[model samples]
Each structure stands twice: as C-alpha cells, then as structure tokens.
Target: MKIILDMMGGDNAPLSNLEGAAQAVKEYGVEIIGLGDEAACRKAAAEKNISLDGIQLVNCTENIEMCDEPARAVRTKKDSSIVVGLNMLKEGKGDAFVSAGSTGALHVGASLIVRTLRGVKRPALATIIPAKNKAYMLLDSGANVECRPEMLAAFAVMGSCYMARVEGRKNPTVALANNGAEESKGTPVLREAHQLLKTTPGINFVGNIEPRDVPNGDVDVVVCDGFTGNVILKLTEGVAKMILGMLKEMFMANVGSKLAYLLLRSGVADLKKKMDSEEYGGAPFLGARQPVIKAHGSSKAKAIKNAIRQAKICVDNDLCGTMQAALDELAAQSAGE
Candidate 1:
C-alpha cells in the first residue's frame, strides 16, 4: 500500500520528513510519496543517501503555515503539500496520508477535504497512550473542544471499534473522564453522556474514570471533551518528565541513592521506554473516509518511520470502512429495540 507524507509540513519540513519517510520505506517495505518542493525534497533525500526505489517525490511550492486559520488555509492553499497529499488520498492515489503540520490544518483537511466516511457525523482523533499492560485510546483529544453528549457517545463507539481492530482488544472498557466516579459527578454533558453509554448495548461502558486512573491503566478508552482529554494527555507527559527528573536528581545526590539507581537501572530503562511518545508514532484521525495519520510535529526519523508502519496497519484493517459498518450496526441495533 502507498502512503503520502506531507514533506513541507511540520517544524522541520522536507528534511526530517524525508529522512523519516525513507526509514519507513526501508524498514516496512512500503511505498511512500513525499509531497513538498520537489527539488528540496530530492536534495534532502540525496544528502541522507535515501534511495528513491520505493519512494517518489511530488512538488508543492506553497504550504499551510501553523499560524494560519486551518479551514481557510486548507481551502485556499492549492499548492500546499498537506492539501495535495489529502487530495491524493481522496482520489485513491494513497492508502493514507501522514502529516506533522498544524493540528488544526490536519483536522480541517481530513474532515473537509478528505471527508468523513458515510454515516460518521463527526470524525474524531484517537491517540494511543502506553499504559502498564496495554495502550488506551483517548478520543477527540483536540478535535471538537466543545463536544455535545451525542458527539461524546459517538467518540466512545468509534474509540471502541478502534481499540478492538487496531489494538486487538475485545470488550474494551469505555469510561467517561470526570472529577469523580460517582454517578452524579460531572457536568450535564458528562451526565447525559454517561447515561447514553451505560444504556448503549454491546459496548462495555464502565462508569466514570478519574484522572488518577488514567496512568494506572484502569480502562481502555477514556472518553472526554477535547479540552479535558488534551489537558490529561499533556499533564501526563509533563508529570512523567518531572518524576523522571526528580528520580535522576535523587540518584545523583548520594552514594546510596546512586547505588540503588544502578540496581534498578534496567527497570527504569523499561519504564522510560514505555513512556516514549515516539515509540507509538502518530495519532490516527478516525472516522474519515480514508485513514489520516498525523505524526508529531517534532518527530524524528523513528517517529516518521513508525507513522508509515501505522499507515499500513490502518489500511490493512480497512479501519475507516470498519468504523462505518460498526456505527451502522450500532444504530440499527438501537433502532430495532
């Protein structure tokens, strides 16, 4: 399968993107088409000694800047690599499109240009968090900041399908992020969403999941408004770094602490590995007609490599089509009763 890379997008455009896309081609044996200023991409590829055997470069002189309005940039920037790559995906030229550009641009481009699958009211962004035993899916992480109850419920349904198909989880527990686990803990939106999820047949809606439970790996999919999910996700990263710093400081403080650190060095290394965001690569924009995986803006070669790998997995599973069918089945089941 072929995947499109927005070579002009992201902070370190063309060069970093080209390097990563090349790594992906070598490791995953997948075809990659890099979109950007063709000459610059080719020059970068030559500098990195990246063979163009399984990769091709496309030209797009203009680009959607991170500060530009997403909807407007996507509509007006005809020569942007991100926009062109998205159009290619819509036209069946590629199985998926990977971008590290503006998050808003990716959201708008996927929803407006690539379009959502039929019957998907709102396409959601799903990010996988590496917890203790398994990864958890957080939906609408930054997609729709002000989500309605129906929208949140749709996130749960789509999130469930994602975990099941991609992560190989069955009966994945769904939880609504809230202040407390009590039934009446959150605002009217969460309260209403809780009721719908609880009553929705077939889905494993486990009660409200607190922020503390998120890192402890208590549930599979944490459903929340984009604001809350984004807060939780960023906080988790911040806290992980803070704790690691504290541990390192303590270890260097005294001979005994340093000795203890040496003893537990392997364990600490494993923990650090588990927490690496780049290991999981990009986040998938779910419910689109075609898969759109958005890699991190600061992604290196490894992250880009894995994003290409993810693109293959998404298409292999026919992820968008699967969600469409599952959502259709869920609606039909609800109506039949």
Candidate 2:
C-alpha cells in the first residue's frame, strides 16, 4: 500500500519523517510518498544516511506552520505540504495520509478534501490509551468539541468497529465516559447517548464508565464528546509523566534507594513503555472517507514508523468500509423507529 507522509509538518520535520519513512520502507516494505521540499528531504536523508529507494518525493512549495490559523492556512496554502498531501489522498493517489502537523488543519483539510463517510455526521479522532490489562480505544479525542446524542452514538459505533477490525478485539465492550457509572448520570446529552447505545445492535454496550475506571481497562471502547475525551487524554498523560518523575527522584535519593531501583529497573522500564503514547503511533480520524492518521507534533522516527504501521492496518482491514456498513445499519434502524 502507498502511504503519503507530511515531511514538513512536525517539530522534527523532514529529518524524523525521512528517517521514519526509510524504516517503514525497509521493514514494512511499503511505498512512501513524501510531501515537502524535495531538495531538503533529499539532503536530510543523505545526512542521516537514510535510504530513500522506496520513497517518492512530491515537492511542495509552502508549509503550514503550527501557529497559522487552521482553516485559513488550509484554504490559502494550496501548495503547502498539508494541503497537497491531503489532496493526494482525496484524489486516491495514496491509500492513507499520516501527519504530525496541526490537528486543526488536518481535521479541516480532511473534512473538506477527503470528506466523511456516508451517514457519518462528523469525523471523530480515536486514540489508543494504555490501560491495566491492555490498551483501549478512546473516541472523539479532540475533533468535535460539541456533539449531540446521535453524534456520540456514531462515535461508539466507529470506535467499536475499529477496535474489532484493527485491534483484533472481538465484540469489544463499549462504554460512555461519564461522571458516574450509573445510567442516569451525566448531562442530558450523555444520558440520551447512553440510552441510544444501550439499544444499538452489534456493539457490546457495557453501561457508563467513570473516568477513574478507564485506567483499569475494564472496557474496550470509551466514547465521549471531543471536549471530554481530550481532557481525559491530556490528564492521563500528565499524571503518568508526573508519577514517573517522582519515581526517578525517589530512586536516586540515596545509595539504598539506588540499589532498590536497580532491582526494579526492568519492571520500571516496562511501566514506562506501557505509558508512552508514542508506542501507539498516532490517533486516527475515524469516519473519514479514507484513512488519515494524526501523529504527535513532537513525534520521533519510531513514532512516525508506528503511525505508518497503524495506517497500513486501517487500509488492510477496510476500516472505513466497516464503519460505513455499521453506520448504515444504524441509519436504517433509526428510520424504522
């Protein structure tokens, strides 16, 4: 499968992206289309000794900076890497698009260029959150800030399809993120969504899940509006980092503590790996007509490679098609009601 990557989009632009593309090519045996300054990409690849034999460079004249307004930048910068890369996806030049660029710009461009799946109201971002038993899918991570009951119901459907098709989870349990575990808890929108999901066929809707239970990984899919999902994702990341920092300071406090740390070093490393968001590569913008992955802005080479892998899985499993079928069933059910 051919993957289009935004080479000039992230903080580690060009270099990290090129390195990741080289690794993906060598390891995954996939063709990578690099969208950026062709000269710069070539120079960086040479300096880093990254083989570009499997990469095709598409020269882009402009780049959309992180600070630029999302919609405006996409509209005005026709030749920018983000716009051009997305256009390529829209035109079916590539199977999927991966970018570590501005989240806003990516969402805007995908919505306008690639378009959303049929019967989908708005595309939602789904990220994998590391949990106790295993990682789980968190939907609406930061796409649409506000949403209706039906929109959230759609998120649950898409999240379920992704977890099953891509993550290999069978009949994943779906849960709504709420203040309490009770069905009657949460705002009117969530309450309505809970009721809707309870009746939605195909999904294994498991009652509401409080934010605290999320880390335990009891549920396979957690659905919420973009605002709540973003808050939960950021808070979890911050807490994990703070705890790890505290552990490091304690481990180096004295000779005895240092010895103790030596004994637990392996376990600590495992913990850190589990908490690292980069391990999952990036979040996918579900409901889009084609696969579009949003890697972290500061993603390193490894993270970018993982993102490419994730996109490949999406394409291989026909994620968008599965979501469309699920959504069509929901629409038909609603019409019958």
- Poorly placed runs, candidate 1 (over 4 Å): 252-264, 334-337
lDDT of 1 by residue, 1-337 (tens): 7999888776777777877887888788889888888998778778878777788888888989889998999889988988899999999998899998888888988888888876566677788887876778888787778889877877888888888887789889999999999989899988989888887756799999988878877788999988887887788888888999998999999999999999999999998989988888888988788989988888887788888888888888988888888778777766897
Model 2 lDDT per residue over 1-337, tens place: 9999999978999999999888999989999999999999999888888899899999999999989999999999999988999999989999999999999999999899999998787789899999998899999998899989999889999999999999899989999999998888999999999999998877999999998899999889999999999998999988988988999999999999999999998999898898888889999999899999999989999999999999999999999988999999999998999
TM-score of each: 0.94, 0.98
TM-score for candidate 1, please give it: 0.94
Worst 10 residues of 1 by lDDT: 116-125
The alpha-carbon deviation from the true structure for residue 114 of candidate 2, after best TM-score superposition, in angstroms, is 0.2
Please give the CA lDDT of all the candidate structures.
0.84, 0.92
